[model samples]
Target chain A: MSSAEKPLIGHLVIVGVGLIGGSVSLALKKAGVVGHVTGVGRNRDNLELAQRIGIVDAWTHDVGEAVRDADVVLLAVPMSAYASVFAAMAKTLPEHAVVTDAGSTKQSTIIAANKFLPGPERFIAAHPIAGTEKSGAGAAFAELYEKRLCVITPVGDSSATALALVMQLWEKTGSRVVTMDAAEHDDFLASVSHLPHLAAFALVNAVRRQKSEGHDPFCFAAGGFRDFTRIASSSPEMWRDIALSNRDALLGQLDAFQQELNGMREALLADDADRLLKEFSAAREAREAWLAKHGDGL
Target chain B: MSSAEKPLIGHLVIVGVGLIGGSVSLALKKAGVVGHVTGVGRNRDNLELAQRIGIVDAWTHDVGEAVRDADVVLLAVPMSAYASVFAAMAKTLPEHAVVTDAGSTKQSTIIAANKFLPGPERFIAAHPIAGTEKSGAGAAFAELYEKRLCVITPVGDSSATALALVMQLWEKTGSRVVTMDAAEHDDFLASVSHLPHLAAFALVNAVRRQKSEGHDPFCFAAGGFRDFTRIASSSPEMWRDIALSNRDALLGQLDAFQQELNGMREALLADDADRLLKEFSAAREAREAWLAKHGDGL
Candidate 1:
């Protein structure tokens, strides 16, 4: 890679070397976005694994020590752990270090982050719309971010230089960056990502419970069930944190969705085939309209 | 290929060379499961396309003529159209012809099958859970069933030999077969397939309606939004048929799903982070548990 195109990152620090965090480090190193990466995690085993994999240049358990003198810090832990990590090092971040994150809930994370960091402007929140249902260092991949959307949630008066650097880093890692407010990001995400997770979980649970009543439970889980509930195979701890952190927005979204479903249910109960068909047609029309915008079939 | 492992089919008749229909023809032919494949479609042009693509050895607009001498008749058309096709060809089918279908809802399809064919034993309901958002003969592929699940919904005293032949054809094309009750198949599929389609359409409409309110909604359409709603991109005509045909099961499923969402919303409204976390965790836990049993994940 030419020097100009080379990832100009040097002395990078990554907090929580799990799937998202670990994958980001590998991709950064492979893309030469960062010259060196320091892995930080509360779990010594994870840090050791991250280092042994040749992804992390160095590692430490001390939050401030790991981040001190680093040009960039990437928090890749669960939303629940955000406050503690930030509180541990927020008072000591260097003047020029751009602090970013790979957490799911942007608004709450930023709120937790604001409580610890002295300079809020130095922080940039990112949600990479990439990840498998898998987690941990072993799940890391250099191509994880390729063609994925990385939403940047900007808080008050974020420095342009810092924002641009974060954008450039993600772009180098093969992600398209989209900017939005933290609240909007949370609400939109709840409807799209969080709600789906909830739906998948509930559907699976309902069936599993029914199976416990002595029916062959998993017997009916065909490919459609597998695909529809794929994300349900996610990290429970991480999802729990996300659900808690983005509680209000997710709940609002859930209510809206459930109400629509109830309406459809009523239509079905009355044998209102025409009304049901109308609803289905409306949804089909909307979906087709959206897909047309996504460079797919007309 | 080993003789025992070689494709068992010598002649295949694909009735209704539409998307899934055409795809099945292409896949079986490419896998060497069918030595000579005949194509049948209401649209003469589609049959021509299937023949041009090398998936069809012969082309015919008449369903009865196409399956007259064929070893297998694969009904690859809409569930709504199955009755009409069966009505046209039931009397002309070869005594040895194993008739199978690629319908979404199985119970209704089977019930309808009984009306046309005195020989209900020859009919087998199969759902290959592999497809793209696109449709038609132009989108046919040879490996559509590779590593996919093909659900077989069989009725009373279905011919063992005929079922075996249908099963062998799918297995030769790299599909895993799961035998299920036709009614249960409809219920399971509604939650896993139909609901997701509805959700996708709702999400698209939510955003589209926002755009109509002068919001440049497309700007907010990030990767998460697109992937989460990708099912909405499926063929409107196909989905419309599914939603209507599987109305009862789909409606029941919609009610259950709505209740789950409503519970979450109530928790959120109450600022019951604890309850929100509990429900979300339940969803996550339930999904993960189901996946561990069904998914490659541990």
Candidate 2:
């Protein structure tokens, strides 16, 4: 067979067959690079659905059994479950298998891998920067990762072969792979992703708290508020794990954001119209520039 | 002519014929409820474009000349310019003309109307809860207000005929008209519209502030961040006016939101995963309930 048509993975094991994992399986299968996909999750019904939908070739509830014969294992569970999942599969994981993850925070996942895996060098931490508010195996689609960015953060002892294979796997899924430091990835994501989610959640709660005396604030909420708080409808369990795992970086981001908000508050209280306009204008220009460059792909 | 086909407005004067005013003109023209539309704005090119695109039947730069013989005068300028615009047209405004506004904040517009209109009772203050991040006459469309909400907050002295005509004008644009107290409208809008804009602006600024040492936080921003900060790309001059006009209510919302954010921060700092999850889940539930009721319509 030509190299382009050769199967990159003989057997692929996905630890959590939710949106991210199911999408990866579908993308790889569509690319004809994976011979078989085994979805391993705690939810039996979800696993069955994944298999029925052809997202996976088979399903399993035991992590060790799934990883025992896996040529490549992708851990896509919530951050809180990563350590336990790692420990569960450590003993039975094939030595030849290259391990990777689709976690939001990389540093914590790397730490978990180092602590729980038989060979930490085989684990390549990655985060595909794409998702929707929707979750579950049913939300999975092959085009979910098309043209999206997947960040791979490798450590000092990472196996070059494993890293290359992981990069190639993500490339097969139509992602542009870039390597970054795990700590940097955590910090950057805190600013871009984690902090935005927290802000949306807090904004929703604040508006909800204002519903009093039969006056619903949400009644006046239109498109702007809907788009601003869309992420508030995301999976709370997954976000809670993400927030906890990236606590330090997220806290720093929160502090910076709070300071910025306080400045606006001060401008409003002082009736400083010029200050408010200047800040708002700067933000608009910055956002316009970003949009011009990135084209809002995701 | 039949009542439905008879023109509701013989001569419509639209001051500041940008997105909101131009859209209103186009919708009314499409509904066959307006005879002639006169577009007045500081930007000559935009007014010319509006006239050329049939958004208005005629174009003028002088508000006084435009409103001299009007059946209805719609002020669609920024909130900061309300008093000046009101004063500029007050002298030449026909005694029988019904003055209305498409301003963001009602209380301030009512105050401006009361202070500057020759006949305060003939002025009806309305806030059409519709728009895009785009501006200018080129962005105007007849269906811009379709399935949207337009709030009319009339003062006690507002003439009954004027209020009815103003409501009919909005209804022609396919908007559901709701009458609300001016103070309550400002408060509710602060919670939903104004505060969300501020949060988005503050978030963009916060991320911009983190651009140091060649690390751009915006580079890692994905779909969630893009949606959360979309309004930050809105007209700075317009949002500045809205924020300042609704200062007290917006400040209250900012305070409540800050408190909610602080609660989340405390939970994160204390490593209280349960607290974080509870808060996040509650926010998600509230947003979902709102979406269920409102269907995310603009």
Candidate 3:
């Protein structure tokens, strides 16, 4: 193979090979940048599915065994499992292996890596800002990260070589990589991702509570409600882990949103038409501006 | 022509020929059930566009003149314009004209008709639960209402013949017609539509407030945020009118939703992982059930 087409990773280990992890393996395979992928997960069936679908060259339930000869390792499990996963693979991880993750929250992963891994300096925290309401290996696809933003938050002691390799890994998946502080990443995600999911969950529950003996409010819910609540269908356990991992930032976002909503409720109660119009008009203008700038590709 | 192929209405007058009004006209025309459609709007340019696009065969700036020879008059204007439109068409409306509206809220339209129309009994309050986040005649299409729900709220004094004709009109556009109490329609729509819009608007504003000199929170927003806040891009003035018209019901919904959100906040604050999981799981289950039953067509 030409040097440009040479495999970037000799052996890749993917822990928790679900949507995010499996997609990374598939994407690397599609780019011909990985020699072999080892899928590690708690579920035997899912690991088998990943391998059968060619997302991984081999499958194993043992994380330590899977990462023993890895050139690069990706942790894509639920946030709640990060600590234990790190502990499981730390002792067996190769001295030269570069560790990274496709996590939603960066700071927590950084913390787990620093606490459990022998070579914390090699751990590059990343979050590919892409996914659907669906999960699991079956939902994984090579193009899942194409044209998406992958934010990398490097801790102070992070190895520059390892960071570059992790960056190249995501770039091979057709993602644009940007680096930011871990805390900043958490704050931004709280507003854009975590807050929206919580709002959706609350909205679905609110509508559900309104269901009485004769009236089913969902019967009248059409396109708008459907789209608004789509994220409520996402994995509850995964979201709970995210919420707890980024509790402070998420709680702050929720407070700000609650206050904004209360302002609207006050305007409605007081019959302040002009204020209501102004708030709604401002939101419409801002959203349109955002769509114009971003092109709505996501 | 055979009865099935025959025109249901000889002359149909549509006021405020925007998306909803224009779509109704186009669907009827496509079904060969409407003849000689007359478009009325404050904007001459939009009226001309509607006629040019064949959504209407004729155009007028005067509501009274347009409905003078009408077999059916459809008010598809903003809720704020309902009273004035009814007043304008009241005197010149043909005695046989069956007046109807494709408004978002039924109770408000019914009240406006009762207060301003010469033949209140002939006014049928209807809401076609279908549309995109688009406005104006240019965005309308013949297939907009197909396979959607059209809610009809017949007032106690509503004429049977007028109600039947209105139902037939929506049915011709391929809508599933259902009759409900005006107040009940308002309540259900508050939970499903009005409240969602307000929540979206609030969400956008909350995110916008997070913008600072070095950071624009919107830069990190992706597909989930886009879908969650899509309704925030709707017409502000139109939403303002709906909010005011459906004030009581929407306020009740807002209160319930706020309580639900606060409950989630409490769970997060207490670090009650089990409680958070339970709430999120319940929402996921309910939304999945709704999607299975409704087929997510919307």
In the order shown, the candidates' DockQ scores are: 0.25, 0.80, 0.78
Model 3, span B1-298: residue lDDT tens: 2555657898999887888999999899888887689988888888888878889888988888888899999888888998899999888998988999988888878888889999999999899999887789999999999989999999788899999999999999999999999898998899989999999999999999898777688989998898899999888998999999999999999999999999999999999999999999999999999999885567
Q: What global local distance difference test value does model 3 have?
A: 0.91
Model 1, A44-115: lDDT tens digits are: 887888889977888888988887788999888777778888888876678899989987788888787677
Cα shift from native, residue B27, model 2 (Å): 3.6
For residues A29-147, what per-residue lDDT tens digits would candidate 2 score against the true structure?
Answer: 89888988999998989998999999998998999988999999998888888889999999999889999999999988998999999999999999999887678899999998998
Model 1, position B154: C-alpha lDDT score: 75
DockQ of 2: 0.80
DockQ score for candidate 3: 0.78
Residues A1-298, candidate 3: write the lDDT tens digits.
3556657999999998888999999888898889989988888888888888899899888988889899999998888988999999988999999999988988878988999999999999999998876789999999999999999999889999999999999999999899998998999999989999999999999999889877688999998898899889888998999999999999999999999999999999999999999999999999999999995576
Residue A65 alpha-carbon offset, candidate 2, angstroms: 2.9
DockQ winner: 2
lDDT (Cα, tens digit) per residue for candidate 1, span B1-298: 3456644776788877767877776766666656778888778777787788776888888887777787788888877788888987887888887889888888778888888975789899888777765677888777777777788987777999998888887786677787877888788777667877776666555544434332244444544455556666566667767887888788777777666666656665676766755665666676666666766521
* Model 2 spans with C-alpha error above 4 angstroms: A1-11, A29-37, A48-58, A132-143, B2-8, B30-36, B52-59
Interface Cα RMSD, each model: 4.0, 0.7, 0.7
DockQ for model 1 equals 0.25
